[model samples]
Target chain A: QVRNELALANAQELINKINEKCFSKCITKPGNKLDSSEQTCVAKCMDRYMEAWNIVSRAYISRVQRESQGESL
Target chain B: KELGKFLESENARMRLQQSIHTFTDLCWDKCINKISNKIDRGEETCLTNCVERFLDTSLFIVKRLEETRKKL
Candidate 1:
């Protein structure tokens, strides 16, 4: 129950970051609708952003484990 | 370590929370050139190395600062 709420909050925060970053990177000019290119860019950007998050998560987790083990930084 | 047990430590939880934001922002700039459907191999490698060296630099600085402070 508590863990689920924490996960929800984390997901919300990630969504906010994706919107802010992708908006600037994808939406240069306002159009009547999201043009094909902009839509594609946003879709790709979302995936890449999540990938970036995962990469960091894995690296940091391992580093933390190493630190806890008294391994030299 | 168990995720639930790890979260029980406030210090560990908070440090992780802070580090994730720092690492994500730092690595995003270093690794991401333009958003693409998939992260290329080169970019993926850069992100991992970026995190490792970043922590290395941070530890180095802290050690340097402590030594200098002891001299004062």
Candidate 2:
């Protein structure tokens, strides 16, 4: 219930961040269409962003566990 | 209660979101230079290492701060 809503909100935030970051990086010119090159750039940027997200999540989780272990010791 | 669990999960989600934003900024600065539409092996490795080292730096700062606080 509440958790689902929170997850949705977080996802929305990420989407907004992606739009801001990738749009700036990929779309130098707003052509009639997204243009093939621009579309490809956006696609790749999204993929790389996801990869970065996972890497950060893993690093953060392990650091947290280590810190908690130290607290108990 | 169910409400307590929901709140716990919500906190976790928020934390995850915050970290994602921070890392996106950090790694985006390092790994992404232009719209190449393809991440090379070197950039991918840099992104991974950027995240790991950022966390390490954060932990190191916290530990240093704690020590400083103890001295004060």
Top candidate (TM-score) = 1
Model 1, runs deviating above 4 Å = A71-73, B1-11
User: What does candidate 1 score on TM?
Assistant: 0.83
lDDT by residue (tens digit), candidate 2, A1-73: 7667777887887788778888998887788889887888888888777766776677667767887899999
**CAPRI tier for the interface of model 1:** medium
Highest DockQ scorer: 1
- Provide the clashing-pair count of each candidate structure: 0, 0
Give me the runs in candidate 2 sitting further than 4 Å from their true place.
Answer: A70-73, B34-38, B69-72
lDDT of 2: 0.78
Model 2: how far residue A64 lies from native, Å: 2.6
lDDT of 1 at A22: 84
